[model samples]
Target chain A: MSQEIRKIEELARTIRRDIVEMVYLAKDGHPGPALSITDIVASLYGSLLRVNPSDPEWEGRDRFILSKGHACPAVYSALARRGFFSPELLPSLRALDSLLQGHPVMKKTPGIDMTSGSLGNGLSIGVGMALASGYTKKNFDVFVIMGDGELQEGIVWEGALSAFKYKLGRLIVFVDHNGWQSGASCNDVGGCVSVKSRFEAFGWHCQEIDGHDISAILQAVKNARAETNLPSVIIAETVKGKGVPFMENDNSWHKRVPSKEQYEEAMKILGGC
Target chain B: MSEYKGSREAFVAAMTDLADKDPRVVFVSADSLKAARATNFAEKYPDRYFEAGIAEQNAVAMAAGLAACGLKPYVVTYGGFITMRACEQLRTFCAYTDLDVTFGGLNGGMIGGEREGVTHQALEDIGIVRTIPGVKVFAPADAAETYALAKAAGSLKGPVYFRLGSGREPDVFSPGTEVELGKLRKVLDYGNDVLLLSSGFVLDRVLKAAELLKAGGIGASVVEVHSLKPLDADGVVRELERCQVAVTIEDHTVIGGLGSAIAELAAERCPCRIQRLGIQDVFPESGPANTLADKYGLSPQAIADTARALAAGKGR
Candidate 1:
């Protein structure tokens, strides 16, 4: 494996471990979706994104928004590990007055480009950020990560069409198609046959990849950045509870906390927190 | 009073002037440019202006997005569609995050779109937008106030919802009435028998109603409450204490708009007999602005009659 890819893979595993540990501590949070996007988020923060850890609000830095804000434990972990905040604060997840909220709030959390908890809002906010970059004659890219079921929101399609109409080459979105939504699977809920086809219809340059593959996530984002005319959407197919064997693809893990015993097993499988 | 001008026209003109001065100002419309009087703005600043094509939710979200990137975005659409249709987007992205985007709701109240039915009327918007935290809501009474409010909203640092009356409103303020935010403008302080505290274009009617009350030998005080939210409670209480009873006159629902706000304030601070003059609990059917205003007891004569009855009932 290339050095960068190997390092990103390691970081992804650590982040997955952080996700399991943080949720285990809080005894609440959406762990399934967070685990699913660990690799993609890891790759973005680890290699691709041009962000400064010291200066989280760097004007020239690229922006990333987790539109699926319930899955914020993963992002919080990524940000913490990337040195935006101390990893010690991870245990304070969901705590009152803690920086880490149930959902990502930009004002509270460092390195959060947009405050997003309500699904389908981030992409639209991302479009605004991208529009700002264009209007201000800046060259920073904006990446918005959304969930598969979130596409059901009419606002997502509205933002999708807008991004295209604006021809925001600087905007990139990734739909984590883990196929599982809260309490049910995405197919049973929204019945969206293919994310690739939906985004293609919306006039975005499309790519489908195994979300767990660090190399694939990096390569897809790299290819997306090369295109200068249209916005891109990488439909990353992933498992709901990716790393842990017991939780993997299990609908029950969508918002469930790992019990003490299950937590031990989960941490062991994730190579320890 | 100065010459009558459309509040919507004043809003569009102020926006156009703001965009001309500040390059950061961008106007985003939901295919209501003609209705919002933004055709000239769109033509002149084509690069800055964006048409969301009848998508209020999208336009609102996009405005939030545009505002997030350091540009001031003014979203224009009918009051009914913009506030009710894109309510969640405005709450979540704009108000929740506290982005500096101006939500310009044109045709406020039952004034405009007489033929378009109840869906187009904006009687419930003030109440709907009032419940949201960190959102500055205003209903400009005339063209001058609309222009001032628009300019203020553009310069303000947070989310603002400016309810613009339909075009063709008589001027209530003098030519250069300085529209300071969060301050009540007392249009007429004839007497403190009954204070007619009003907002939006209804202030013009309130002033006229006060005149009719004077002619009928019923003393009345008229206070124009242009700023709906962060409601100048001190100013309101100052006026309320001087009067035995206060009536809140607005072009919105009596539920959560200025009427409810004043009632709540009065109950807490200056407890007095409070009367709310607005649409009761039914959806009013569409008609001509004047016809609807008359039917709903929003006309000068009807308002004066209501005030006379209220004053007589209190044995003033």
Candidate 2:
């Protein structure tokens, strides 16, 4: 493995462990999507992102918006692991006193580019961020990760049109195509099987990549960074509950907390967890 | 008497002027540019303007996105449609996130297109909006006050709603005058006596009623309550406390507009005998603004009659 991939893989394992631990504590969280998105978030924060752990608000840092905000544990894991704050604060997730909320608060959570929980909102917010950057002549890029099912929202299309019209090359989006929503997949919801072609039709630089492959994920990010005229969408192919065998590809685990035994098994699967 | 402007046209003018001065000011319309009178804004700043074409949810969510990226977004649409149709995006994306976006609730009263249908009448917006936290709602009585409210909304520290009347109403301002948020414009104050409070397209009628009441020696005080959310609880108490009689008028339903707000305030702070005059019940059908105003008891003569009746009912 490349040193970069090795580091990212280790970080992803650690984040998966953290995800299992936190939800085991809270007894509530979207474990399936969180686990599915672990590698993506880990790779983004660990390898691809230009963020400062000490100063989350570094003016020149690339902005990130989790459009699929239900997978907040994934984000919180990445943020804590990257040292946005102490990793110990993970237990305080969604706690009354903790700044770390069930949904990311850009004001409270350092490095959270936007506060999002309501589905289909973060993409537009991300587009807004991209537009702001372009209008102000800021060079920083923006990344928005949305749920595959969230594409059903008309606002996503609105943001897509605006993004293309503005020619915001600095903007990139990743739709975590885990093939499930709160109820069904994008195909079952909207008959959209090919996210890459759909986004390309909407005037984006589109690509599909194995969301779990470290090298492929890294290359996709690299290709996205090289493009400079159109906003890009990387439809990451992923399995829900990617690490835990019993829950993988199952929608039931989309938000169900794991039992004590399940947590331990999950931890063991993500070795060096 | 304090000068007040009537109709949504004044709001369009203010947005146009701001769009001209600030390159960052963008007008995102759901094809109400004609009704919103934002054509000048579009003409003056084409690059900064957008048309969403009957897509209110998209328009609002896009506005939220634009606001997030540092673009001050003024979302223009009919009050009924914007509030009812695009409410989810407004509440979740804009109000909850506190996106820096201003809403122009055009054709605020039965005035949007009275004859068009009930859907365009926009009677329930005030009630629906009143429940939300941190949204500043204003029903401008005239054009000058609208520009003032729009300007204030642009510079506001948080989200704001600008309820506007349809154009073609007689201009209420005397060439130059403006109003501000959270501040009531005391039009005609008669000491510790009958107080007439009103808002939005109903202000002209209230002022006219004040004239008739003055002729009758009843001496009605006309207080224009343009801002409803940051309601003047103390000011309301000070003005209506122990007063034998007070009357409130609105073009909206009596449930949650300025009339209900005044009633709630008086009940909590200072108990007083107050009568609310607004749309009693049922959606208004298509008609001219004047005819609709008359039908709803929002006309000057109708309001004057209601005021006299309210005064008499209070045993004044």
Candidate 3:
């Protein structure tokens, strides 16, 4: 493997390690979403996004909102690794009075672009953020990380419809299509689960990618920025609990925090940490 | 004391003034331009005026979308529809995330469209929006005060709900009345016997209540609680402390409106005998605004009667 690809994989491993450690310490955090989107976030922040951790609110900085906020561990882990906050602070997740709550809070957490937990509402907020960037002529793109399960909310379509009406070209959405929700797979849950075609029909320039592939993720974002006429959706197919042997592809990790022993085992599986 | 200016004319007037300074101050509405007095503002500033048809929900969602793109958007429609029908959108995208939105709702009471019956009434809107944190709810009593509230709501840091009665509400305050969200304005000062507080479209009723009390040789202090959410605790407690009787009059309902807000404030801080005179808990019957106010015991006389009873230890 090339050095760049190897480095990307290493960063994803570290992010997953932090996710496991934090959830294990808190004894209660959704590891599935975090693990699933680790590579997607790493690719965005590490490679594609035009953001400054030092100047987090820079007028022209790219915006990212976690619409499926329950899976905040992935984004938070990425933010910590991106040097927005200390990686050491990751273990404080879910503690009382900790800045890191179970869900991402815009006011509370730096690098968190919007306060979200309400499923399907995050994209609406993201629509606003993207629109705001366009309105102010800030020239910064807005990114929304949504979940397939969260797509069931009627408000998402309401927002989706508005995004197209405004032709918010800078709006980029990455749907974590891990195929599982809190109940079961998204297909079992009612509503439009075909995120790729849904966006295309909504007039969004659409593409589907393997979410774990850093190179593919980078290419999708670059392609989105190049599109001048319409918004874009990268419906990334990801595996819930992606890396660790026990957690990978498991629905139980939706809100499961790894135990201390399990954490060690998972980290060791990534190779003797 | 400054005359009580209503919010309806006030909101448009403020928008007109803002349109002069800021080119991006856009007003999106669901076909109430003439009633909201936005006709002149629209003509004067056509670029800033956007009529969104008869869709309140779509209008709000569009405003949320506009706000996303950094446009300062003020959405106008009936209080009943804007807060009730599109409440989910308001809560999800606007209030929860603290978007920069100004919602100007008219017919705040049974003020306008009372002829249209229960569906058009905005009796519960103030109470409904008060529950959402971080959003300001302002009800300006008269025309001048309404304009002031509109300016503040427009330039406000976060989301705000500004209400005004429909049509020609009495200009309670003289011209140039100053108002702010979450601040209470005292109208007439009474010594220490009765305190009568009122909100939008009911300042005249409040004034009448005070005069009736004065005729009966009871001093009644009248206050305009324009800002409802961050309830003016200090003003309420101080009024309760000096008063033997308290009466809250509004053009809204018994549940979650102005009366309950004042009563809750009084009960928690300075407990006192209180009579909340407003709409009944049932859907209001179609009639003239004044007729319905009387039928629901919300007129000045009814408020006076209830207050006298509370003053005489007679209300249940």
Candidate 4:
């Protein structure tokens, strides 16, 4: 692997460690969802995104929205490590008065583009941001990450239709296709037949890639950015609880707190940054 | 009174005027642009206008996104759709985020959507929006008030919901009337034997009701409460304290609307005997707008009768 990819992989490992730690410390969070998107978050924050942590509200900065906001631990970790805020605040994941909220709140947290906790809302918000960029000639891209199960929401297709109608080239989305939702597997819950074909039918530029592959994730984003005439959706095939062996593809970890022994074992596997 | 005009027309004109002054002003429609009479805005500022194509949820969320990006967006559609269908988006995306987005909800009361029937009437919009924290709800009494409120909404910091009327609404306020946000506009102030608190297009009917009360030797004061969320609590309390009986008249349900707002305030501050003159917790049928309103107990005659009875201590 090249040195840059190695560095991003290392950052991704650290973010994974942070996600596990934050959820373990909070005693309450969606660990599986957070882990599923850790690499993607790391890939974006580590490289590609043109954002200044010091000036979080800079008009020229690219915007990022976490549509499946229960997965916020990953984002909170990435934002902190990206120097938007101190890394010390990572443990205060869902505490009252903490900047890191259970869901990503744009007003409370730096580097957050839109306040999103409700499913199927981020894409529409991204469309608006993309439209605003075209309107004001700001020339900033809007990135969004949604869950595979969130596709069942009717509003998601509405947003897809809007993005296509507007031809929002700067808006790129990543569907963390972990195959597992909170209740059961995505297929068991039904209606998520083919995410790629669905988005393609809506006239989006579509790509499918291994989400855990940092290089592949970056390449997909680059490919998305090249398509300046349409919105892009990278259906990243991710494992539900990635990085740790016992939690991998385990639906129980969707919201369960890690036991002390499990926590120690998970940390041993994740290792030091 | 000035020449009667449609609230939807006035709202579009105000928004178009705002677009002329502020480049960031944009309009998002959910396939209801023609209903909103916003073709002028769409024509003048083609780039700023967006259509979400029959998707109220997407339109609202998109507007929130635009507002987050420092652009003022107005999402115009049927009042029921904006308040009921996309209610969650308005609550979470706009109100929770405290975004500078305005919702122009057309056909705001029982008088609206007479041909389209019960499905289109927005009797519960005010109640739904009022409960959402940080959303300023304005049910303008007429076209003039709607214009002023729409313009004022542009300068306001957070989310606003304007409960507008159908094009057939009669003129209540004259042209160029300055509407202060969150303050009651006193229309008719006679001896305070009874206080008639009115909101939205029903103010005209309430005014007539006040006149009827006067003819029957019962002096009634009519106050137009345009802003329902940031209600003029102090002004309303002062009026309630003077009158022995207070009646709230609106084109919405008595529950969780203007009547409930007044009753909640009066119970805490003044403890006055009150009557809520509106649709009494029932769905209205499809008919002529005036006929539906009259059947639903929102007519001038019914309002006058209720106030007279309360003033004479007949119905305590």
Candidate 5:
């Protein structure tokens, strides 16, 4: 592995540990969803996205939106680890009056680019941001990470149509295809037949990769950036509650808090003290 | 007949003027460019105009995004579509975030959607939008007021929803009327035996009702409520205190709209008898705009009758 890839993998491990700890400490959060996107979040914040942690609202910086905002533990961890805020704030994930909200609120959080809690809004916001980049000649890319089940929202397709119609090349979306939703499997609830074909039908550049593989995720982004005439969607196949053996692929862990034994087991599995 | 321009035309003209002054001003249309009378704006600033193709939800969310990027974005479409179809997007994306997005909702109330029917009319827009926190709701009485509010919205710092009329609305305010936000513009006042509180395109009817009340030996004061949210509560209360009874006339449902605002305020501040003259809690059928207005209790005769009865202490 290249040194850069190794560094990103290490960062992903740290972010996963942070996600576990944050959810465990808060006693209420979507840990499975957060863990699913930890590597993808790490890949973007640690290696790909051009952002200034000290200056969160830098005009020229690329923007990131976690559209599946219930997964904000991963983003909060990524932001804290990248020096946007103190990592000490991670434990207060859903605490009252904390800067970190249960959902990603751009006004409240320092590093959050868009306020998103309602599913299917982030991509449209990204389309607007990307359009702004063209109008202002900023040339900054807008990235959005959505959960697989969020595809069921009709507005997501509407955003897809706008991105395609406007030819927003700077807008990139990653569908964290973890397969499980809150109540049941995503397919059982609402089967989005062939996520790749669906986006491709909208004339978007499409790629599918292992979401946990930091190197592959980085390469997909690189390829997405190369395509300047269309929006790109990277369907990242992820395992819900990844990096923890007992929690992996367990839908019950979607929003459940871990017991002391489960917490210790998760920490040990994540290679953290 | 008094000369009048379409409120939609005035809205587009004001937006065009705003765009001419500020380069950050942009327009997002949901396939209603012609309906919004925004073709002139599109022609003037082609690059700044976005066509969202009948997707009001996406249009609103996208406008929120543009606003977040420090650009002033105006999402223009039918009032029903903008307020009802994209209600969640407006609440969560724009109002909750407090983005500076100016929304121009055309065909507001029973006076619009002449042939398009109940599906197109926006009788509940003010009620739905005003309930959302951090949203400034404006239902302009005339083209002049629409132009002034649209221009003023450009300078405001938060989300604004402008409830506009169809192109055929009658002239209430003359040209070059300076309409301020959150201030009640008094139209006419006699002995203050009854207060005629009006909003949106129904102001002309209310004015005619005041003349009828005068003919019936009931002195009436007329006040136009353009801004529904951040309402001039003290001014309205003062008028309420002076009058023996207050009647709220709007081109909307009596529930959760101008009438509700007046009733809520009067109940809290000054206990006064109020007869709300609007749609009487029923879905209006498709008909000519004038016929619909008359059937829905928004006619001049209805307003005058209500005011006359309330003034005589014979109203509900």
Candidate 6:
């Protein structure tokens, strides 16, 4: 593996470790979705996105919104790792007056582009940002990370259609297709509707990839940037509760905080704190 | 007080003026351009005006996203759909985030869309939006107030829900009335016997009722509460304290509208025989604006009669 790729992979592992630690300490948060988008977030922040952690609100920086906001731990860890805030603050997740909220709040957190916790809101906000970028003559791209289950929200499709209609080429969405929802699998809850086909019908430049692979995410983003006619969606097929062996693909971890023993096991598996 | 026109027209004119002055200002409508009088804005600033079909939810969220990009976005639609359908988005994306997105809830209250029935009425829009923490809710009584509030909404920091009545509303203030945010303006401060607090297009009715009560030797004070959410508590409470009887009249339902807001305040601060004169917890009938207001007991005579009853030691 290339040295740069290896470094990114290492960062993803650290992010995963932080996600587990944040959820375990807070005893609150959705770790399953957090872990599901770790690599996608790591790839975006580590490689593709033009951002300055020192100047998080720089006008020229690319914007990122965690639409499936329950998955904020991964993005929060990435922000801290990117030097947006202190790494020590990660343990204070969901704590009173802490910068790391249960969901990504823009005013509270430095790197968060838009405040999101309610499902299906991020993409619409992203479309706005993309349109604003055009209006202001800024070339900065807007990225939104959404959960697979969040697609059930009718607003998502509404935003999808509008984004396509407006020709928001800079608006790229990464759907963390981990399959499992809070209590049941997405297919079990809502009938098997191919997310890729849905986006295709909406006229998005849709691509499917192994979400765990950092290189694949980077490549898809590059390909997406090439398709300037429409908005892009990288349907990253991820495993819910990805890194930890016991939690991997487990629906229980969707909202479950790790026990002391489970925390220790997860820490060891993700190369520890 | 001076100029007379439809609040919707005034709202659209003010927004278009803001769009002309500020490049960052944009308007997103849910295919209600004609109803909202935004065709001129769409023609002039085509790039800034977004037509989001009949999707109020999408329009609101899209406006929030636009605000995130440092642009001032105004989401315009009928008050019913804008407040009822896109309510969650207004709370989550706009209010929670404190985005600079103004929600122009056109055609507010029971008298807004005459003959359109209960579905078109936005009686609970103010109550619905007032509950949000960071959202500033305003119900303009006339074209002047609507224009001033709409102009101010573009510059406000966080989310603002500006309630505008449809059709021609009586001129409650002069064209250049200094309508400050979170300040109540006394329209008729006649007597200390009764104080009538009102908002939206119903202020004209309350003022007329105050005149009738004054003529009948029962003095009534009419105050126009433009801002509902950061409600001028001190001003409202002060007015409430001065009178023996208090009445809140609106074009909305008696529950959770101006009446409830004032009653909630009166219950805590000042104890008085309060009469909430509005649609008394019932679906307003479909008819002309005047007919609906009259049928729902929200007309000037009905309000005056209620005030007369309250002043005569009758509990409401």
Fraction of the real A/B interface contacts present in each candidate? Answer: 0.74, 0.49, 0.25, 0.84, 0.77, 0.84
On a 0 to 1 DockQ scale, where is model 3?
A: 0.23
Candidate 1 stretches greater than 4 Å from native = B1-4
Instruction: Indicate the TM-score of model 1.
Output: 0.97
Query: What would you estimate as the lDDT of candidate 2?
Result: 0.79
* Tens digits of lDDT, candidate 5, A28-93: 999899999999999998888999998998998998989999999999988998999999989999
TM-score of chain B of each: 0.95, 0.92, 0.92, 0.97, 0.96, 0.95
Error of 6 at B228 (Å): 1.4
Interface RMSD, all models, one decimal each?
1.3, 2.5, 4.0, 0.7, 0.7, 0.9
- lDDT tens per residue, model 3, B188-272: 9765567788888778877887788789977778888888877788877877787757888888886888888888887777777
Q: What do the candidate models score in CA lDDT, each in turn?
A: 0.86, 0.79, 0.78, 0.90, 0.89, 0.87
Model 6 achieves a DockQ score of 0.81
Q: Look at candidate 2 and tell me the lDDT of residue A34.
A: 90
Error of 6 at A86 (Å): 1.0
Docking class of 2: medium
Clash list (residue pairs), candidate 1:
A128-B65
Over A158-247, each residue of candidate 6 has an lDDT whose tens digit, in order, gives 889999999999999999999988869999997799999999999999999999988899899999999887999999999999989899
lDDT of 3 at A183: 84
Candidates in order, TM-scores: namely 0.97, 0.92, 0.88, 0.98, 0.98, 0.96
Per-residue lDDT of candidate 2, residues B76-129 (tens digit): 889888899888878877787787788988767776557666778788788878
What's model 4's lDDT at B114?
66
Better model by TM-score: candidate 5 vs candidate 6:
5
Q: What is the C-alpha DockQ of each candidate?
A: 0.75, 0.50, 0.23, 0.88, 0.86, 0.81
What is the Cα-based TM-score of model 2?
0.92
DockQ of 5: 0.86
Candidate 2 per-residue lDDT over residues A1-273, each given as its tens digit: 789999999998888888888888988888888988888899999988898998886766788888888889988989988989888899888899787888887768877877788788767667667766766576788998998888888778877887787787889898898889887665887785577767978889998999999888889888988988988889899998888798898888988888878888887887724
Which runs of model 4 end up more than 4 angstroms from their true locations?
A: B1-4, B314-316
